[model samples]
Target: MPDQVLELAGVAVLVCDPAGPPVTTTQDALDLIGAAFLGAEVVAVPASRLNEDFFSLGTGFAGEVMQKFVNYRLRLAVLGDISRHLAASSALRALVHESNRAGHVWFLPDLDALEARLTTPT
Candidate 1:
């Protein structure tokens, strides 16, 4: 599926397709600046499209990517069901919880949840 930009409420969001190449590195995160600059305040990337290391809390892959997004002042939502990975690691669950609370990095269950976040009055 081709990637596209969407408007959730008044928020401009860019939803990346899971079918494309995985964004696994810090450089990949920086590469997304093009979309952000184009008025994408939020980016929704599927969990399946992320590198496995992102789920391995010890690897710090998620943190690196999140940092890049945060530096750009753009929000990131990791969408789709990641139950298996979460079931395997309590640390990941805790990390996700903390990240969600931060409001910049989110691990959402689906696109609808991402839409909610974008639409919810903040």
Candidate 2:
């Protein structure tokens, strides 16, 4: 399936296809960000679509990718459970906590959570 843009909770969201290519590099992330420019205020990517290095903060891939979205003024919602990654790294856990709190980059459990976040008053 191809990626699609949908309106959710009054926000235009570009929901990426899980079957599509994995986001492994900053260039790949930039591609997605560019795609989201089609009237999308947010980009929702499945956790499965992310490269393994994305969860390993030591590689700095996660920070780079996320910074791109922020720099472009686009919100990113990483959709799916990341318990194993969070459990392994204290720094990652802290990052998730802070990111979610900041409302720019969110590591959410699923689409429902993302919708809830969009609908909820901040």
Candidate 3:
């Protein structure tokens, strides 16, 4: 499937599919950011599209990728339920919570939630 780009309350969002290459590294994140540069302020990547290392806090993959996104000033919303991953790692759960609270990154359960969050006045 292809990536869908949409405008939610003037915020450009790139809704990516899980069928493509997994985004697990800083370079992968940079590539995704490049795609979003077409006019996207955010990239909504499904949880399934990420590598296993991304969920393992010790791997540092998530941190590296997210840092790249932050450096580029682009927001990221990891779409879908990652309950298993969260349950398995306390660090990751805290990471998700902190990221969501920070407003730059979020691990949401679905696209509807994503749209609602992005559309709401911040």
Candidate 4:
């Protein structure tokens, strides 16, 4: 796995590629967030590289990650289209819809959209 800080749309983002199972353990998620928060205003995680499940982090692991997001008051941007996931799970599609409605996280199509969303005034 490779983890590093990257600048996106004038924001420093900590990017990580676990290159294994799609699921990220809560502990690992926390560690990544902690590291990312230091140098970046936002964190972008690639769903494909981390896990193989329908949802990038898997449903169980995603809940834990969401808790961390609340605890840290951090905004998360998940990169890539989730067409594969949408095809696999109706529940996941609903979850993604709810997440977007809440505005704490975003499942964006590409870096440009991600960057624009991050930089645009809320």
Candidate 5:
């Protein structure tokens, strides 16, 4: 299925298909960012769609991809449970903790949580 736009809490979010291509490189992230430009204020990517390198902070892949979203003023919501990845890396856990506190990037457990965040005033 192609990416679909959702209007949640008065925000336009491009929800990427979990079965779609993996986001492995910075360029791939850029492609999503560009796509979101059409009518989305945020881009929701499934945790399964992210590359392994993204969870490994040493590779800086997560930072690179997230920075692109930040630079473009487009929020990124990573959906699905990533407890396994969080269990393996303390750095990633810390990153997620911090990112969740901000408005730029979010690592949500599911779409319901994303909607809650969207509905709540930041």
Candidate 6:
């Protein structure tokens, strides 16, 4: 019954609170995803507050964590609009693009869109 894990459209998702800085360390991200994956096939990371030190997952942090996701074949979903981040460094934009293209991650605007994607056949 924890908010962390829920079933929607026959897919399991692990939702993490995005109230503060994004998890910057790979260990933290891994721990979070590992815990969530216990009951879900996907992980949802909310974007409540952008991290000051690093964008999402900190600078150069996403790649490392992403590798783990690839290894585990886990899907990651970042819920929120990224209009403000569009102006960020080109590297960040590239990373976001790569993540999306990999089909293992997403940066959606809202829960509805996220749910839609989750339900849609891949």
Count residue pairs with overlapping backbones in model 1: 0
Ranking by TM-score: 5, 2, 3, 1, 6, 4
Off by over 4 Å in 6: 20-22, 49-58
**In TM-score terms, which candidate is top?**
5
Query: Mind giving the per-residue lDDT tens digits that candidate 1 earns over 1-122?
Result: 76788898788888887897788887777767566687799988888888999999799887888888888899999998888999999999998888877778898988888887776754
- What TM-score would candidate 5 get against the native? 0.98
**Residue-level lDDT for 62 in candidate 1:** 79
Residue-wise C-alpha lDDT for candidate 4, range 2-87, written one tens digit per residue: 77777877778776664633444677667767777676766677767445532644546677777787778777777886788788
Q: Which pairs of residues clash in candidate 4, taking residues 3 or more apart in a chain or in different chains?
A: 21-50, 21-51, 22-50, 22-51, 22-52
How many pairs of residues collide in each model?
A: 0, 0, 0, 5, 0, 0
Tens digit of per-residue lDDT, candidate 5, span 90-118: 98999999999999999998878999999
**Candidate 3 colliding pairs, count:** 0
Better of 5 and 6 by TM-score: 5
lDDT of 2 by residue, 1-108 (tens): 799998899999999998999999999999999999999999999999999999999999999999999999999999998998999999999999999998799999
- Give residue 50's lDDT in candidate 2 (0 to 100): 95
Name the 10 consecutive residues with the lowest summed lDDT in model 2. 113-122
Q: On residues 1-122, what C-alpha lDDT tens digit does candidate 3 reach at each position?
A: 69878887678899897797888677888889999999999999999989999999888888888888888999999999899999998999899888887788989998888888877755
RMSD of each: 1.3, 0.8, 1.2, 3.0, 0.7, 2.9
Residue clash pairs of candidate 5: none
TM-score, per-candidate, Cα-based: 0.92, 0.97, 0.93, 0.77, 0.98, 0.78
Model 3 steric clash pairs: none
